[model samples]
Target: MTFSKPYATREALEQTIAHHAWLNEHAGSLRLPAIRTVRADGIDFASIEGRHARFTDAPAVATVLGRAHAAAWKGDLHRALLTTAHPLAHGHELPDFVSPRIAALRRHRAAGLVNAHQMTAAQSLLAASPATPVAFYKDTNLRNVLITADGPVMVDLGDLTLAPFGYDLAKLLVTLAMTYGPLPPATFTTSLACYNQPLLGAGLPPVTIGRFLGHAELHHLLTLPYLGKSGYRHPWPTVRPRPEDLT
Candidate 1:
């Protein structure tokens, strides 16, 4: 993929290489594009093995996430990644990536990036809960998912980390919501239940869906300025979320 701005640090690139290497060997049923080659500037992704799909394709998104949620859901892979102390695994807590972004927003508020109100709201949301850790494929969002004839494929391993249970699901839901307005109440609730199934089956505590949604919202709010008016279906924060909207 091409990017106008560089997307990786040396350290993150190394971790991504390692993670993909691991996936190449171990991702049995998880669909991933083959890493064709790696060079100084970037890695090459192989041509789509099936039909190229759009991020807006809802069915495709669900199918891919289901594959990930079930096939690699919290068990051996979680322990294996932890055992190796994988650099991509931000152990047992949500990474502190948000704090630095908030700081940057404050510093650039004069540039109209984020206002004081948004910053304060973000801080409060950050304090809402001590997120319970679960196996989070942090980059499992609409932008990174692809639907192929074989099934669904997820791409971008750079941000995989151990984060709050459903963090990855929340990110996907939030990404879709931001792009297409709030999901229907039934859809939101069903999605939450589906994401919590594996954890519950494993006798882990169920995710607090609201808290996960809140955290996901904060993540997208912090991301707004960078979007530079991409014409999303809804403007966030000002959208005044409804309880049913997240149910």
Candidate 2:
């Protein structure tokens, strides 16, 4: 993405370029794209080298999340990030993203924009889940992941941070649903189980589709104001799987 006026300052552009360089130094081990940064005539541009396909399907999403999570949990890489204490590491900030005020949700609900039942369920899920923070790639949305012949590669490495165990996966799952509607109930269950195996292996907490969907719903509600009423459409169908069906 080009870093230009009305979007980012010159200092911000330079910082991004430096961060890309730092990430590239560990590209081989981390499976990240090599970014080539350029500046010309007062405009700065950053381009990822090599041809890669965007991961679009549910199975692809599961596979990539498993691999990325495994990599992030590796002893040496995990230690390196923690030791550096990078400013990008958003400590205890994931809750803020999913936990919007009741008054705000009420406003949306009153406008017929958010479902009252869904909002209550989401709040319950967040309350039940553990609040302890863990190191995570806070921005694992599909746009940042690409598929090459070898495997998936993550770009936009700047958002590495600390959040609850499942926040990253939840973010991607929600983004997937937003882009291409919700997955079938069986499909969602299978995918969650697939990714959870690695987390279990790493001694990290397994993600529940129920809790993540709760997060997804709240996130969707939060974005509506920014997206504007005219530009928004609900991603899930009316015939959704019952709450009991989610794990």
Candidate 3:
């Protein structure tokens, strides 16, 4: 593969290359398409052999999400969360959110997409909380998950890492919430219930589900600009949610 244009910096380029290598080496085990080549601008994905399929041509607002929920209607989402044990179980510490991310939250507040009440409460809670690592899908969302008859396969390999369990849950749920706006509290119960307590197992503590949901809410605002088409239309904070309101 060849990049039509280079990545923003050397570090970005190197990271992309590394992720590509990881994905290439592990795609079959990951149940994903092998990459014969990848560059900053293009990729050559090995075709699926049999009756492969996509989620839908015109996924309704919740189609990808609903499908994810239905697919995981069984147990063990952590299995779904990672491609394999290949990455050496990354991100043991909760890395600090960078400055640009903070700025995006500020922008959300400024644009009335997030209010001070939610912001303050979430920030305070996050600041006080210690890091707890679990499976993390950094870009966990409808867009990143692929459906095959074989089962669910995580497509975007780069974002897979070990992070707070709440974080992985938050990103997928919040990623949906961001696109469709605030779903009723019952939405999580019905659609996201597969990842609930029984599945998390007793070895881990109760995840700060709301706190991490808030983090996911804040985390993706900065990411919108980079996501073409994906960034369109989801006017956030129009109703001014409390931090715990993300159900």
TM-score for predicted model 3 compared with the true structure: 0.54
Predicted structure with the largest TM-score when compared to the true one: 1
How close is every model to the real structure, measured as TM-score? 0.69, 0.60, 0.54
lDDT of every model, 2 decimals: 0.56, 0.52, 0.44
lDDT of 2 at 39: 55
lDDT of 1 by residue, 1-247 (tens): 5222233565555566766655444434467677766666566766554433333455445444543544443533444322123333332222343444456666657678667887777767644243333344546656676677666676777765444456566666666666667656555567666656655665567667677667677667656664535434565554435776665
RMSD after CA superposition, every candidate: 5.3, 6.1, 8.0
Instruction: Pick out the ten consecutive residues of candidate 2 with the lowest summed lDDT.
Output: 88-97
A best-first ranking of the candidates according to their lDDT comes to 1, 2, 3
Look at candidate 2 and give me any clashing residue pairs.
Answer: none
Off by over 4 Å in 2: 1-7, 14-30, 38-56, 73-133, 157-161, 225-233, 236-241
* Candidate 3 runs further than 4 Å off: 1-10, 20-31, 38-43, 47-100, 103-122, 158-162, 180-186, 190-192, 197-199, 219-231, 238-247
Model 2: how far residue 129 lies from native, Å: 8.6
Overlapping backbone residue pairs in candidate 2 total 0
> For model 3, where is the 10-residue window of minimal lDDT?
52-61
